[model samples]
Target: MQDGNTNTPEVETETATDWLTQLKNVIIEYAPAVIAALVILIVGLFVINMVVKLAKRVMEKRGLDATLQKFLGNLLSWTLKILLFVIVASKLGVETTSFAAVIGAAGLAIGLALQGSLSNFAGGVLIMIFKPFKIGDLIEAQGVTGVVKEIQIFTTQLNTPGNKLAIIPNGSLSNGNIINYSAEGILRVDHVIGVSYDADIKQTKEVLMQVMQANDKVLKDPAPTVNVSELADSSVNFAVRPWSTTANYWDVYFKVLEDAKIALDAAGIEIPYPHSVEIHKGE
Candidate 1:
Protein backbone atom coordinates (compact mmCIF):
# COMPACT_ATOMS: atom_id res chain seq x y z
CA MET A 1 0.00 0.00 0.00
CA GLN A 2 1.12 3.53 -0.78
CA ASP A 3 1.80 5.92 2.11
CA GLY A 4 -0.77 8.36 0.53
CA ASN A 5 -3.57 5.83 1.37
CA THR A 6 -3.51 7.24 5.00
CA ASN A 7 -5.39 10.38 3.72
CA THR A 8 -8.45 8.31 2.71
CA PRO A 9 -8.76 6.75 6.23
CA GLU A 10 -8.46 10.21 7.81
CA VAL A 11 -11.30 11.57 5.62
CA GLU A 12 -13.59 8.64 6.61
CA THR A 13 -12.93 9.24 10.34
CA GLU A 14 -13.81 12.95 9.95
CA THR A 15 -17.09 12.15 8.23
CA ALA A 16 -18.20 9.78 11.06
CA THR A 17 -17.30 12.41 13.68
CA ASP A 18 -19.36 15.11 11.89
CA TRP A 19 -22.50 12.89 11.83
CA LEU A 20 -22.27 12.18 15.59
CA THR A 21 -21.81 15.89 16.39
CA GLN A 22 -24.95 16.85 14.48
CA LEU A 23 -26.99 14.14 16.27
CA LYS A 24 -25.73 15.40 19.66
CA ASN A 25 -26.61 18.97 18.72
CA VAL A 26 -30.14 17.92 17.81
CA ILE A 27 -30.60 16.10 21.17
CA ILE A 28 -29.32 19.08 23.14
CA GLU A 29 -31.70 21.45 21.37
CA TYR A 30 -34.83 19.32 21.87
CA ALA A 31 -34.27 17.60 25.23
CA PRO A 32 -35.56 20.55 27.31
CA ALA A 33 -38.69 20.88 25.20
CA VAL A 34 -39.49 17.18 25.61
CA ILE A 35 -39.09 17.41 29.36
CA ALA A 36 -41.23 20.55 29.52
CA ALA A 37 -44.01 18.90 27.51
CA LEU A 38 -44.13 15.98 29.94
CA VAL A 39 -44.31 18.28 32.96
CA ILE A 40 -47.10 20.29 31.37
CA LEU A 41 -49.05 17.17 30.47
CA ILE A 42 -49.00 15.78 34.00
CA VAL A 43 -49.64 19.09 35.72
CA GLY A 44 -52.27 20.07 33.21
CA LEU A 45 -54.24 16.90 33.85
CA PHE A 46 -54.18 17.50 37.58
CA VAL A 47 -55.30 21.10 37.15
CA ILE A 48 -58.10 20.03 34.86
CA ASN A 49 -59.42 17.59 37.42
CA MET A 50 -59.34 20.25 40.11
CA VAL A 51 -61.19 22.71 37.90
CA VAL A 52 -63.90 20.19 37.13
CA LYS A 53 -64.39 19.41 40.78
CA LEU A 54 -64.55 23.06 41.73
CA ALA A 55 -67.07 23.77 39.01
CA LYS A 56 -69.30 20.96 40.23
CA ARG A 57 -69.23 22.34 43.75
CA VAL A 58 -70.14 25.77 42.49
CA MET A 59 -73.00 24.44 40.45
CA GLU A 60 -74.36 22.46 43.39
CA LYS A 61 -74.21 25.51 45.64
CA ARG A 62 -76.08 27.53 43.06
CA GLY A 63 -78.98 25.05 43.22
CA LEU A 64 -78.68 24.21 39.57
CA ASP A 65 -80.64 21.30 38.24
CA ALA A 66 -78.80 18.00 38.71
CA THR A 67 -78.90 17.01 35.05
CA LEU A 68 -77.74 20.42 33.93
CA GLN A 69 -74.96 20.36 36.45
CA LYS A 70 -73.53 17.14 35.06
CA PHE A 71 -73.83 18.29 31.46
CA LEU A 72 -72.12 21.58 32.12
CA GLY A 73 -69.36 19.97 34.10
CA ASN A 74 -68.59 17.50 31.34
CA LEU A 75 -68.64 20.19 28.70
CA LEU A 76 -66.26 22.36 30.66
CA SER A 77 -63.88 19.49 31.21
CA TRP A 78 -63.75 18.53 27.53
CA THR A 79 -63.25 22.12 26.44
CA LEU A 80 -60.44 22.70 28.86
CA LYS A 81 -58.75 19.45 27.96
CA ILE A 82 -58.88 20.33 24.28
CA LEU A 83 -57.18 23.62 25.02
CA LEU A 84 -54.56 21.84 27.09
CA PHE A 85 -53.93 19.40 24.26
CA VAL A 86 -53.23 22.27 21.90
CA ILE A 87 -50.79 23.77 24.36
CA VAL A 88 -48.97 20.49 24.81
CA ALA A 89 -48.78 19.93 21.09
CA SER A 90 -47.37 23.40 20.49
CA LYS A 91 -44.85 22.95 23.24
CA LEU A 92 -43.60 19.80 21.51
CA GLY A 93 -43.00 21.74 18.29
CA VAL A 94 -46.25 20.78 16.57
CA GLU A 95 -47.80 23.53 14.46
CA THR A 96 -50.93 24.67 16.28
CA THR A 97 -52.78 25.79 13.15
CA SER A 98 -52.21 22.55 11.30
CA PHE A 99 -53.17 20.49 14.36
CA ALA A 100 -56.36 22.46 14.75
CA ALA A 101 -57.23 21.88 11.10
CA VAL A 102 -56.82 18.14 11.52
CA ILE A 103 -58.98 18.20 14.63
CA GLY A 104 -61.63 20.23 12.86
CA ALA A 105 -61.78 17.83 9.96
CA ALA A 106 -62.09 14.86 12.31
CA GLY A 107 -64.82 16.60 14.24
CA LEU A 108 -66.71 17.30 11.06
CA ALA A 109 -66.58 13.68 10.07
CA ILE A 110 -67.84 12.54 13.46
CA GLY A 111 -70.63 15.10 13.43
CA LEU A 112 -71.85 13.94 10.09
CA ALA A 113 -72.04 10.39 11.36
CA LEU A 114 -74.05 11.37 14.44
CA GLN A 115 -76.66 13.80 13.20
CA GLY A 116 -79.48 12.44 15.32
CA SER A 117 -77.37 12.42 18.46
CA LEU A 118 -76.38 16.02 17.92
CA SER A 119 -79.96 17.00 17.35
CA ASN A 120 -80.96 15.36 20.62
CA PHE A 121 -78.19 17.16 22.43
CA ALA A 122 -79.36 20.51 21.09
CA GLY A 123 -82.91 19.64 22.03
CA GLY A 124 -81.84 18.78 25.56
CA VAL A 125 -80.13 22.12 25.87
CA LEU A 126 -83.27 23.89 24.75
CA ILE A 127 -85.36 21.91 27.22
CA MET A 128 -83.10 22.87 30.09
CA ILE A 129 -83.09 26.51 29.14
CA PHE A 130 -86.84 26.70 28.72
CA LYS A 131 -87.71 24.69 31.85
CA PRO A 132 -90.68 23.10 30.15
CA PHE A 133 -91.05 20.03 32.32
CA LYS A 134 -89.39 18.94 35.55
CA ILE A 135 -89.01 15.71 37.43
CA GLY A 136 -92.24 14.20 38.77
CA ASP A 137 -94.33 16.35 36.46
CA LEU A 138 -97.17 14.47 34.80
CA ILE A 139 -96.92 15.29 31.12
CA GLU A 140 -98.06 14.07 27.75
CA ALA A 141 -95.51 14.24 24.99
CA GLN A 142 -94.74 12.30 21.81
CA GLY A 143 -98.07 10.54 22.31
CA VAL A 144 -97.00 9.01 25.59
CA THR A 145 -98.53 10.12 28.89
CA GLY A 146 -96.41 9.65 31.98
CA VAL A 147 -94.55 11.20 34.86
CA VAL A 148 -91.15 12.65 34.02
CA LYS A 149 -88.62 10.41 35.68
CA GLU A 150 -85.49 12.04 34.35
CA ILE A 151 -84.24 14.58 31.84
CA GLN A 152 -80.97 13.48 30.35
CA ILE A 153 -78.62 15.05 27.86
CA PHE A 154 -79.95 13.09 24.90
CA THR A 155 -83.24 11.66 26.06
CA THR A 156 -86.12 11.96 28.52
CA GLN A 157 -87.30 9.13 30.75
CA LEU A 158 -90.97 8.64 31.47
CA ASN A 159 -92.69 6.37 33.94
CA THR A 160 -95.90 5.48 32.17
CA PRO A 161 -99.22 4.75 33.83
CA GLY A 162 -98.74 1.06 33.17
CA ASN A 163 -95.48 1.23 35.14
CA LYS A 164 -93.37 1.01 32.02
CA LEU A 165 -90.21 3.02 31.50
CA ALA A 166 -90.21 4.92 28.21
CA ILE A 167 -87.05 6.55 26.89
CA ILE A 168 -87.83 9.18 24.28
CA PRO A 169 -85.27 11.03 22.24
CA ASN A 170 -85.05 14.67 23.31
CA GLY A 171 -85.14 15.80 19.68
CA SER A 172 -88.63 14.50 19.04
CA LEU A 173 -89.92 15.28 22.52
CA SER A 174 -88.86 18.90 22.33
CA ASN A 175 -90.35 19.34 18.89
CA GLY A 176 -93.64 17.64 19.76
CA ASN A 177 -96.54 18.95 21.76
CA ILE A 178 -96.26 18.61 25.53
CA ILE A 179 -99.26 18.81 27.83
CA ASN A 180 -98.12 19.51 31.37
CA TYR A 181 -100.98 18.45 33.54
CA SER A 182 -99.48 19.57 36.82
CA ALA A 183 -98.31 22.97 35.65
CA GLU A 184 -101.29 24.88 37.02
CA GLY A 185 -101.66 22.66 40.11
CA ILE A 186 -105.28 21.99 39.19
CA LEU A 187 -107.06 19.97 36.49
CA ARG A 188 -110.61 19.78 35.22
CA VAL A 189 -111.94 16.26 34.89
CA ASP A 190 -114.45 16.22 32.03
CA HIS A 191 -117.21 13.66 31.90
CA VAL A 192 -120.02 13.22 29.42
CA ILE A 193 -122.82 11.29 31.11
CA GLY A 194 -125.77 9.82 29.21
CA VAL A 195 -129.03 9.05 30.97
CA SER A 196 -132.36 7.77 29.67
CA TYR A 197 -134.30 10.54 27.86
CA ASP A 198 -137.11 9.72 30.30
CA ALA A 199 -135.13 11.27 33.18
CA ASP A 200 -135.86 14.94 33.86
CA ILE A 201 -133.03 17.22 32.77
CA LYS A 202 -133.18 19.29 35.97
CA GLN A 203 -133.06 16.16 38.13
CA THR A 204 -130.09 14.75 36.17
CA LYS A 205 -128.13 17.97 36.55
CA GLU A 206 -128.80 18.14 40.29
CA VAL A 207 -127.77 14.50 40.79
CA LEU A 208 -124.48 14.93 38.88
CA MET A 209 -123.66 18.18 40.66
CA GLN A 210 -124.17 16.54 44.04
CA VAL A 211 -121.74 13.74 43.11
CA MET A 212 -118.94 16.27 42.44
CA GLN A 213 -119.72 18.39 45.49
CA ALA A 214 -119.78 15.41 47.86
CA ASN A 215 -116.22 14.43 46.92
CA ASP A 216 -113.69 16.14 49.20
CA LYS A 217 -110.99 15.98 46.57
CA VAL A 218 -112.91 18.08 44.07
CA LEU A 219 -112.15 21.79 44.11
CA LYS A 220 -114.88 24.16 45.25
CA ASP A 221 -113.46 27.49 44.15
CA PRO A 222 -113.77 27.00 40.38
CA ALA A 223 -117.13 25.42 41.09
CA PRO A 224 -118.24 22.22 39.36
CA THR A 225 -120.82 22.61 36.60
CA VAL A 226 -123.37 20.17 35.14
CA ASN A 227 -125.12 21.19 31.96
CA VAL A 228 -127.18 19.31 29.41
CA SER A 229 -124.82 19.29 26.49
CA GLU A 230 -126.83 17.26 24.02
CA LEU A 231 -129.91 15.10 23.60
CA ALA A 232 -128.95 12.03 21.60
CA ASP A 233 -131.44 9.66 20.02
CA SER A 234 -131.55 7.45 23.13
CA SER A 235 -130.59 9.64 26.08
CA VAL A 236 -129.79 13.13 27.31
CA ASN A 237 -126.07 13.88 27.58
CA PHE A 238 -124.82 16.00 30.44
CA ALA A 239 -121.39 17.54 30.63
CA VAL A 240 -120.14 16.88 34.15
CA ARG A 241 -117.07 18.99 34.76
CA PRO A 242 -115.22 18.71 38.05
CA TRP A 243 -112.18 20.68 39.12
CA SER A 244 -109.64 19.04 41.41
CA THR A 245 -106.05 19.35 42.43
CA THR A 246 -103.70 17.69 39.98
CA ALA A 247 -102.66 15.09 42.49
CA ASN A 248 -106.26 14.13 43.21
CA TYR A 249 -107.49 14.24 39.61
CA TRP A 250 -107.71 10.52 39.01
CA ASP A 251 -109.22 9.87 42.43
CA VAL A 252 -111.94 12.43 41.88
CA TYR A 253 -112.55 11.18 38.37
CA PHE A 254 -113.06 7.53 39.35
CA LYS A 255 -114.99 8.27 42.52
CA VAL A 256 -117.44 10.60 40.84
CA LEU A 257 -118.18 8.09 38.11
CA GLU A 258 -119.02 5.37 40.64
CA ASP A 259 -120.95 7.68 42.94
CA ALA A 260 -123.04 9.10 40.11
CA LYS A 261 -124.30 5.65 39.21
CA ILE A 262 -125.23 4.93 42.82
CA ALA A 263 -126.99 8.27 43.23
CA LEU A 264 -128.87 7.82 39.97
CA ASP A 265 -130.09 4.39 41.04
CA ALA A 266 -131.27 5.78 44.38
CA ALA A 267 -133.21 8.49 42.57
CA GLY A 268 -134.78 5.88 40.24
CA ILE A 269 -133.13 7.53 37.21
CA GLU A 270 -132.75 5.02 34.43
CA ILE A 271 -129.51 4.47 32.44
CA PRO A 272 -130.97 2.77 29.41
CA TYR A 273 -129.66 -0.49 27.98
CA PRO A 274 -130.87 -2.29 24.87
CA HIS A 275 -132.83 -5.53 25.40
CA SER A 276 -132.58 -8.62 23.20
CA VAL A 277 -135.61 -10.37 21.61
CA GLU A 278 -135.73 -13.81 19.98
CA ILE A 279 -138.27 -15.39 17.55
CA HIS A 280 -139.06 -19.11 17.11
CA LYS A 281 -137.43 -20.72 14.07
CA GLY A 282 -140.55 -22.80 13.24
CA GLU A 283 -144.24 -22.18 13.86
Candidate 2:
Protein backbone atom coordinates (compact mmCIF):
# COMPACT_ATOMS: atom_id res chain seq x y z
CA MET A 1 0.00 0.00 0.00
CA GLN A 2 2.90 2.38 0.80
CA ASP A 3 4.56 1.62 -2.61
CA GLY A 4 1.21 2.13 -4.41
CA ASN A 5 0.64 5.55 -2.75
CA THR A 6 4.17 6.77 -3.75
CA ASN A 7 3.61 5.54 -7.31
CA THR A 8 0.24 7.41 -7.49
CA PRO A 9 1.85 10.73 -6.51
CA GLU A 10 4.53 10.30 -9.21
CA VAL A 11 1.85 9.54 -11.78
CA GLU A 12 -0.08 12.69 -10.86
CA THR A 13 3.10 14.82 -11.23
CA GLU A 14 3.74 13.37 -14.71
CA THR A 15 0.15 14.17 -15.79
CA ALA A 16 0.50 17.81 -14.74
CA THR A 17 3.88 18.17 -16.52
CA ASP A 18 2.47 16.57 -19.68
CA TRP A 19 -0.45 19.05 -19.67
CA LEU A 20 1.92 22.03 -19.41
CA THR A 21 4.16 20.65 -22.19
CA GLN A 22 1.12 20.24 -24.50
CA LEU A 23 0.08 23.84 -23.83
CA LYS A 24 3.57 25.15 -24.68
CA ASN A 25 3.73 23.10 -27.88
CA VAL A 26 0.34 24.39 -28.97
CA ILE A 27 1.50 27.98 -28.53
CA ILE A 28 4.73 27.23 -30.42
CA GLU A 29 2.73 25.76 -33.31
CA TYR A 30 0.48 28.83 -33.78
CA ALA A 31 2.80 31.70 -32.86
CA PRO A 32 4.34 31.98 -36.37
CA ALA A 33 0.94 32.06 -38.05
CA VAL A 34 -0.28 34.79 -35.69
CA ILE A 35 2.87 36.83 -36.21
CA ALA A 36 2.63 36.40 -39.99
CA ALA A 37 -1.02 37.45 -39.98
CA LEU A 38 -0.16 40.57 -38.04
CA VAL A 39 2.67 41.44 -40.41
CA ILE A 40 0.39 41.07 -43.43
CA LEU A 41 -2.29 43.23 -41.87
CA ILE A 42 0.15 46.04 -41.20
CA VAL A 43 1.93 45.78 -44.54
CA GLY A 44 -1.32 45.46 -46.49
CA LEU A 45 -2.73 48.60 -44.97
CA PHE A 46 0.38 50.57 -45.90
CA VAL A 47 0.36 49.28 -49.47
CA ILE A 48 -3.35 50.07 -49.81
CA ASN A 49 -2.77 53.66 -48.80
CA MET A 50 -0.01 54.08 -51.33
CA VAL A 51 -2.15 52.55 -54.07
CA VAL A 52 -5.02 54.89 -53.27
CA LYS A 53 -2.74 57.90 -53.45
CA LEU A 54 -1.37 56.75 -56.80
CA ALA A 55 -4.88 56.24 -58.13
CA LYS A 56 -5.88 59.75 -57.09
CA ARG A 57 -2.86 61.24 -58.82
CA VAL A 58 -3.71 59.37 -62.00
CA MET A 59 -7.29 60.61 -61.88
CA GLU A 60 -6.10 64.14 -61.31
CA LYS A 61 -3.82 63.94 -64.30
CA ARG A 62 -6.67 62.69 -66.44
CA GLY A 63 -8.77 65.68 -65.45
CA LEU A 64 -11.49 63.52 -64.02
CA ASP A 65 -14.16 65.00 -61.80
CA ALA A 66 -12.79 65.87 -58.37
CA THR A 67 -15.76 64.16 -56.73
CA LEU A 68 -15.20 60.96 -58.65
CA GLN A 69 -11.54 60.98 -57.75
CA LYS A 70 -12.21 61.16 -54.04
CA PHE A 71 -15.03 58.59 -54.14
CA LEU A 72 -13.00 56.11 -56.13
CA GLY A 73 -10.02 56.54 -53.86
CA ASN A 74 -12.11 55.76 -50.81
CA LEU A 75 -13.79 52.80 -52.48
CA LEU A 76 -10.50 51.30 -53.56
CA SER A 77 -9.12 51.67 -50.06
CA TRP A 78 -12.02 49.77 -48.47
CA THR A 79 -12.03 47.09 -51.14
CA LEU A 80 -8.35 46.43 -50.59
CA LYS A 81 -8.80 46.44 -46.85
CA ILE A 82 -11.63 43.88 -47.07
CA LEU A 83 -9.46 41.66 -49.25
CA LEU A 84 -6.57 41.98 -46.82
CA PHE A 85 -8.89 41.17 -43.94
CA VAL A 86 -10.10 37.99 -45.61
CA ILE A 87 -6.53 36.95 -46.41
CA VAL A 88 -5.47 37.49 -42.81
CA ALA A 89 -8.52 35.62 -41.51
CA SER A 90 -7.81 32.61 -43.74
CA LYS A 91 -4.23 32.62 -42.54
CA LEU A 92 -5.54 32.43 -38.97
CA GLY A 93 -7.71 29.38 -39.87
CA VAL A 94 -10.96 31.38 -39.80
CA GLU A 95 -13.37 30.39 -42.56
CA THR A 96 -13.75 33.69 -44.48
CA THR A 97 -16.46 32.53 -46.85
CA SER A 98 -19.02 32.95 -44.10
CA PHE A 99 -17.07 35.89 -42.68
CA ALA A 100 -17.48 37.87 -45.91
CA ALA A 101 -21.22 37.25 -45.88
CA VAL A 102 -21.39 38.49 -42.34
CA ILE A 103 -19.52 41.65 -43.32
CA GLY A 104 -21.87 42.24 -46.27
CA ALA A 105 -24.95 42.01 -44.07
CA ALA A 106 -23.51 44.38 -41.52
CA GLY A 107 -22.60 46.84 -44.29
CA LEU A 108 -26.13 46.73 -45.63
CA ALA A 109 -27.61 47.52 -42.23
CA ILE A 110 -25.20 50.38 -41.68
CA GLY A 111 -25.97 51.75 -45.12
CA LEU A 112 -29.68 51.84 -44.41
CA ALA A 113 -29.12 53.68 -41.15
CA LEU A 114 -26.92 56.33 -42.81
CA GLN A 115 -29.12 57.14 -45.80
CA GLY A 116 -29.32 60.84 -44.97
CA SER A 117 -25.57 61.09 -44.63
CA LEU A 118 -25.21 59.35 -47.97
CA SER A 119 -27.45 61.94 -49.56
CA ASN A 120 -25.30 64.73 -48.21
CA PHE A 121 -22.22 62.99 -49.50
CA ALA A 122 -23.82 62.70 -52.92
CA GLY A 123 -24.69 66.37 -52.81
CA GLY A 124 -21.12 67.26 -51.97
CA VAL A 125 -19.99 65.21 -54.91
CA LEU A 126 -22.30 67.08 -57.23
CA ILE A 127 -21.18 70.42 -55.84
CA MET A 128 -17.57 69.53 -56.43
CA ILE A 129 -18.19 68.24 -59.93
CA PHE A 130 -20.43 71.09 -61.11
CA LYS A 131 -18.12 73.80 -59.75
CA PRO A 132 -20.90 76.19 -58.81
CA PHE A 133 -18.71 78.10 -56.38
CA LYS A 134 -15.31 77.76 -54.76
CA ILE A 135 -13.61 78.87 -51.61
CA GLY A 136 -13.16 82.68 -51.25
CA ASP A 137 -16.00 83.25 -53.71
CA LEU A 138 -19.00 85.36 -52.75
CA ILE A 139 -22.21 83.41 -53.07
CA GLU A 140 -25.88 83.79 -52.28
CA ALA A 141 -27.77 80.62 -51.57
CA GLN A 142 -30.60 79.49 -49.32
CA GLY A 143 -31.55 83.08 -48.42
CA VAL A 144 -28.03 83.87 -47.23
CA THR A 145 -25.26 85.87 -48.85
CA GLY A 146 -21.70 85.16 -47.78
CA VAL A 147 -18.19 84.25 -48.82
CA VAL A 148 -17.55 80.54 -49.10
CA LYS A 149 -15.02 79.58 -46.46
CA GLU A 150 -14.71 75.83 -46.83
CA ILE A 151 -16.30 72.84 -48.53
CA GLN A 152 -16.39 69.43 -46.94
CA ILE A 153 -17.88 66.05 -47.65
CA PHE A 154 -21.25 66.72 -46.00
CA THR A 155 -21.38 70.45 -45.41
CA THR A 156 -20.20 73.90 -46.53
CA GLN A 157 -19.10 76.85 -44.43
CA LEU A 158 -19.67 80.54 -45.17
CA ASN A 159 -18.58 83.79 -43.59
CA THR A 160 -21.28 86.45 -43.72
CA PRO A 161 -20.81 90.20 -43.58
CA GLY A 162 -22.13 90.13 -40.04
CA ASN A 163 -18.95 88.19 -39.09
CA LYS A 164 -20.92 85.02 -38.37
CA LEU A 165 -20.12 81.53 -39.60
CA ALA A 166 -22.93 79.76 -41.40
CA ILE A 167 -22.95 76.02 -41.86
CA ILE A 168 -25.12 74.62 -44.64
CA PRO A 169 -25.70 70.99 -45.42
CA ASN A 170 -24.40 70.03 -48.84
CA GLY A 171 -27.64 68.22 -49.65
CA SER A 172 -29.70 71.40 -49.64
CA LEU A 173 -26.96 73.57 -51.07
CA SER A 174 -26.57 71.39 -54.12
CA ASN A 175 -30.32 71.48 -54.84
CA GLY A 176 -30.79 75.22 -54.32
CA ASN A 177 -30.18 78.15 -56.64
CA ILE A 178 -26.69 79.50 -56.10
CA ILE A 179 -25.79 83.03 -57.13
CA ASN A 180 -22.04 83.45 -57.56
CA TYR A 181 -21.32 87.14 -57.38
CA SER A 182 -17.63 86.66 -57.96
CA ALA A 183 -17.98 84.55 -61.08
CA GLU A 184 -17.59 87.49 -63.44
CA GLY A 185 -14.74 89.01 -61.41
CA ILE A 186 -16.50 92.35 -61.64
CA LEU A 187 -19.77 93.51 -60.10
CA ARG A 188 -22.15 96.34 -60.98
CA VAL A 189 -23.21 98.73 -58.24
CA ASP A 190 -26.54 100.45 -58.93
CA HIS A 191 -27.68 103.68 -57.36
CA VAL A 192 -30.69 105.90 -57.97
CA ILE A 193 -30.31 109.58 -57.04
CA GLY A 194 -33.40 111.78 -57.00
CA VAL A 195 -33.11 115.51 -57.69
CA SER A 196 -35.53 118.43 -57.99
CA TYR A 197 -37.12 118.64 -61.44
CA ASP A 198 -35.54 122.09 -61.87
CA ALA A 199 -32.01 120.64 -61.60
CA ASP A 200 -30.15 120.53 -64.92
CA ILE A 201 -30.06 116.97 -66.18
CA LYS A 202 -26.79 117.38 -68.05
CA GLN A 203 -25.09 118.98 -65.05
CA THR A 204 -26.32 116.22 -62.76
CA LYS A 205 -25.00 113.60 -65.15
CA GLU A 206 -21.57 115.24 -65.40
CA VAL A 207 -21.37 115.78 -61.66
CA LEU A 208 -22.31 112.17 -60.87
CA MET A 209 -19.93 110.83 -63.48
CA GLN A 210 -17.12 112.97 -62.06
CA VAL A 211 -17.84 111.72 -58.55
CA MET A 212 -17.66 108.08 -59.65
CA GLN A 213 -14.52 108.70 -61.69
CA ALA A 214 -12.83 110.39 -58.78
CA ASN A 215 -13.00 107.25 -56.65
CA ASP A 216 -10.01 104.89 -57.11
CA LYS A 217 -11.99 101.75 -56.42
CA VAL A 218 -14.36 102.12 -59.39
CA LEU A 219 -13.32 100.45 -62.63
CA LYS A 220 -12.49 102.87 -65.42
CA ASP A 221 -12.58 100.37 -68.28
CA PRO A 222 -16.35 99.84 -68.09
CA ALA A 223 -16.86 103.56 -67.48
CA PRO A 224 -19.53 104.60 -64.97
CA THR A 225 -22.76 106.02 -66.45
CA VAL A 226 -25.34 108.52 -65.26
CA ASN A 227 -28.70 108.86 -67.01
CA VAL A 228 -32.04 110.51 -66.20
CA SER A 229 -34.08 107.41 -65.48
CA GLU A 230 -37.41 108.78 -64.30
CA LEU A 231 -39.24 112.12 -64.54
CA ALA A 232 -41.47 111.71 -61.50
CA ASP A 233 -44.06 114.11 -60.07
CA SER A 234 -41.69 115.55 -57.45
CA SER A 235 -38.17 114.79 -58.59
CA VAL A 236 -36.10 113.54 -61.48
CA ASN A 237 -34.34 110.28 -60.76
CA PHE A 238 -30.85 109.69 -62.14
CA ALA A 239 -29.48 106.15 -62.36
CA VAL A 240 -25.84 105.95 -61.36
CA ARG A 241 -24.17 102.76 -62.43
CA PRO A 242 -20.58 101.92 -61.53
CA TRP A 243 -18.45 98.90 -62.15
CA SER A 244 -15.77 97.65 -59.75
CA THR A 245 -13.83 94.54 -58.92
CA THR A 246 -15.86 92.20 -56.76
CA ALA A 247 -13.53 92.88 -53.83
CA ASN A 248 -13.93 96.64 -54.18
CA TYR A 249 -17.66 96.71 -54.90
CA TRP A 250 -18.95 98.00 -51.60
CA ASP A 251 -16.12 100.49 -51.23
CA VAL A 252 -16.89 102.10 -54.58
CA TYR A 253 -20.60 102.05 -53.82
CA PHE A 254 -20.39 103.96 -50.57
CA LYS A 255 -17.68 106.32 -51.79
CA VAL A 256 -19.66 107.26 -54.87
CA LEU A 257 -22.84 107.79 -52.89
CA GLU A 258 -21.28 110.07 -50.26
CA ASP A 259 -19.12 112.05 -52.68
CA ALA A 260 -21.98 112.46 -55.11
CA LYS A 261 -24.09 114.00 -52.38
CA ILE A 262 -21.35 116.41 -51.38
CA ALA A 263 -20.57 117.26 -55.02
CA LEU A 264 -24.26 117.93 -55.76
CA ASP A 265 -24.55 120.14 -52.71
CA ALA A 266 -21.51 122.17 -53.78
CA ALA A 267 -22.75 122.41 -57.39
CA GLY A 268 -26.17 123.76 -56.30
CA ILE A 269 -27.96 120.66 -57.53
CA GLU A 270 -31.18 120.54 -55.54
CA ILE A 271 -32.10 117.12 -54.15
CA PRO A 272 -35.85 116.92 -53.59
CA TYR A 273 -37.17 116.62 -50.05
CA PRO A 274 -40.75 116.60 -48.75
CA HIS A 275 -41.86 119.89 -47.11
CA SER A 276 -44.90 120.22 -44.85
CA VAL A 277 -46.95 123.12 -46.14
CA GLU A 278 -49.06 124.85 -43.38
CA ILE A 279 -52.25 126.82 -43.95
CA HIS A 280 -54.02 129.23 -41.52
CA LYS A 281 -57.74 129.96 -41.85
CA GLY A 282 -59.50 133.05 -40.31
CA GLU A 283 -63.17 133.02 -39.42
Candidate 1 C-alpha lDDT tens digits along 228-262: 89988888888999999988988998999999999
* True-structure Cα RMSD, model 1: 4.0
Tens digits of per-residue lDDT for model 2, 122-215: 8998887778998899999999899999888899899998979999989999999999999999999999999998889888899999999888
lDDT for model 1, on a 0 to 1 scale? 0.93
**Local distance difference test, each candidate:** 0.93, 0.91
Q: Which residue segments of model 1 deviate by more than 4 Å?
A: 1-27, 277-283
- The TM-score that candidate 1 achieves is 0.87
Candidate 2: list runs displaced more than 4 Å: 1-36, 56-79, 93-97, 277-283
Residue 6 C-alpha lDDT in model 1 = 62
TM-scores of the models, in the order given: 0.87, 0.79
